[model samples]
Target: MVTIKDIAARLEVSASTVGRALADDPRISAAMKQKVQEVANDMGYVVNRAARMMRGVSSNLVGLVVPDIRNSFYSTIAHALSKCLESADLQLTLSETDDDRLVELRHIRELTSVNVAGIIIVPTARPHPESVRLLKMTSCIQLLRRHASLGEHWFGIDDTQALFQATRHLVELGHQRIAYIGGTTDLPTGAARLQGFHGAVAGSKAAAHVREELGAPASTDFGRDAIRRLLALRSPPTAVVLGSVQNTQGALEELHASGVSVPETLSVVGFGDELGFRWWGPGLTTISLPVSELATACGLWFIHQLKQKSANPAPYSSVSPPTLVVRGSTRAVEAANASRAPARSRQLAG
Candidate 1:
């Protein structure tokens, strides 16, 4: 491995001068910095980032933790965040927690121990004690799902509002028997979205129409299972609202398997506008998350924190509002379904 000393020897400059030039320190003349960088590049001299981090120098690495990258929503957020941070000359290190508290805690500790500039996390539903301790040693920006215990800066969507609009859209379309399939209340997102769904139902004059089937983890399997249970009911819902993109995909797969035609037989509204949804048999109506905006805000705030260690920016908890996109998947309830009032009553019975 080529060292800074070797580069300095080739350039006829002190090792200290080479270091300053590589760092682009304002004190170094632009011409000299350019010359040293070109020589360093030719010599294949790499900065000893690990050594500099050990000496308490802020690293150019930022850590990003998410539950599942396979989920399109999280994957999109990760991509947006990567682009935003890269523009500022910072690199991103990703850790997938798989929604496990222990794994989350381990990742947090590992990142902080390596002296990453900061971490942006979509924390697990349950709080881990190790998360609290390690977070104190670094800057953290919570995303999407926040564990109430770790009161960090949060950049997320208005989950409640998102669900409320979705549910209300079905209601407006004359969907009296509507079912909600979503994640458990352990996570803030689950809780907020559930609350929103119920709030819309409670406030609606057609309050008796909505059925909720939450408590399952947010996954494709959960979506599939929830749809099965909903359909098994004597008077199945004429419409369904899914809380996440993964859930939507799973639910739609089950619906397809069951031969239930969308819009004609059942209306559906999904969370997060995944690309595949547009080309699906019927274009899916969904709530579009402002992923780019959320990522930009988190990246900027984290970079600012790294620069001003003492600067206490207000506790930011802003939410990017979601947009409800109408498509071919949702339609007004059929006449036969609307007339089965007694069937709806029995369906809700224990």
Candidate 2:
């Protein structure tokens, strides 16, 4: 709680002198600035950033809003962003929105209230109109997921392309029956991913049998349920292409619990090359996204704009291509019996 008055009292100097010294103003001599700084540090005096902002000083703190941090995807991006921002002497303040529009709106209001240098958010599928209005008025970058209302200040991977690549990989492996488990079409990302899966199937020369299971606000539980339903079907998929991290986790868990052997019995393709995915049962064949690189690129661009003091930075967006990492989780259908019967449990239904 130490303030300018406390430092002033200790140095026996005026409060204005203390303030100017702390700010490293040219009016203050080097000796006086050092003296005031040393005293301020010794007395535990912290800079009141809000007060400085009221006087029109820009904050060095930036805001990062995400839907969920439990998933390593968000955490990885946070780490990359913090490192780049720190290199620029900017600090990151993170807020979790739980993918809720109301929570997103509140967080936006608070960040703008303090006049943060800028905001980088992995916005919800549908952002609040008010939140969009406020973001349009500030230096904001949308990450991963973008709402059309937020314009093109965005950086993300192609969701549709990722799924298309995954599905096509399965198709190329000679798997005729494939199931896709992911989010509902209510989310733009979900819609795009579904479109990609369908596109791959439609374009395939082979007779691809498609089984899609989409749930609103997809989670591990939904993933498990979807996989269970697909497996209980009369014609279970020979291979499964997971559409999200949660779906991958859930499907993998169900496969393990049901004692279904990966590739040997049921082939699996997962989204998000999470570190642990490499060790899950058989190593997971997955879509590898350059999440860290994307984060670093966005962070650097935002820092550049901040330094340039561009009140209205041009609308810029970039898409990173996802790579399909072939691992032990998938196999060619040629090795299996001609029946193409999936070996997973047929008793449980989604």
Candidate 3:
């Protein structure tokens, strides 16, 4: 195996100089660093992660914990994170929690045991105090989610502001009877989104028309069930806003099965632009979550934490606003209910 000493001798530099250059120390000039790197590469010298860990240094491995790896939103962010980590010559270890707190705790423990240099997690619904404390053992960054009491590194979209804007859009389109479908009241994201929905509807003339159904996280089955319940209401909503892309798919399927024409009988808006939306159908009107941007911010934050060596220290946080993408799924209120003919015309025709 090629060793650092071999590279150092080949480059005619002291072993300590080679080490500092390899570490990219400020004391080493750029030209010397480049020369040392070139010799190391030519010699096929690879840093042994085990040796570095034994020396009590960074492992150059990052752990990424996500609620559901199957979800496109999470997968998208994972892809971005992986790419970013790779650029920094680091490796990524991924763990799927399936939105279960117990499973997430286990994953966190495993990552720490491996001496991962840093961790980026999308926490489960409620903040787990034990889990939060455990995270202090390693550099941690929270992504695409937030915790209320447990202050720590975080980066995610402002879901409340996003949902508020979405609701206002429907109201501006004259959609007096608008309903929300997705998320249980227990989850922070769910509760915040609900708050935004109510904030937009409060004191409005159409407040009476606003309804909500707290369901599972962005599942098609949940969407179907929520839609069924909404349609059974005494006065069904003319429009619906979905909390996730997965749920939107289910909602659309149920509506199609019921022979309900979209925008004519019902207009819909969903969160997360997601993949294949354009080719799926007429395309869904949605709030794009800026998944890549959030991932990049999380990766950079994790890197910063790694350098600071401050585990469990709460860092400055930021939230990005959601961007609305208008598409074929949503329409004006009059267009949405055009299927209902005037009572006078029906009586005369009869």
Which regions of candidate 3 fall more than 4 Å away from where they truly are? Answer: 1-21, 24-44, 279-281, 304-314, 341-350
Candidate with top TM-score is 1
If ranked by TM-score, best first, what sequence of candidates would result? 1, 2, 3
Cα lDDT tens digits, model 2, 219-306, are 8999989988988899878889999998898888888888776776778999999888998876899999999999999999998888
Using lDDT, give the best candidate's number.
2
For residues 45-111, what per-residue lDDT tens digits would candidate 3 score against the true structure? 9987777777787677899899888788788888999988887778888999888889998998888
TM-score of each model, paired residue for residue: 0.92, 0.89, 0.84
Query: Which lDDT tens digits does candidate 1 get at residues 227-269?
Result: 9999899988888999988899899888777766676667889
**Can you list the residue pairs that collide in candidate 1?**
none
Total backbone clashes of candidate 2, pairs 3 or more residues apart or in separate chains: 2
Listed per model in order, the count of residue pairs whose N, CA or C atoms clash below 3 Å is 0, 2, 0
Ranking by lDDT: 2, 1, 3
Cand. 3 Cα-lDDT: 0.79
Worst 10 residues of 3 by lDDT: 341-350
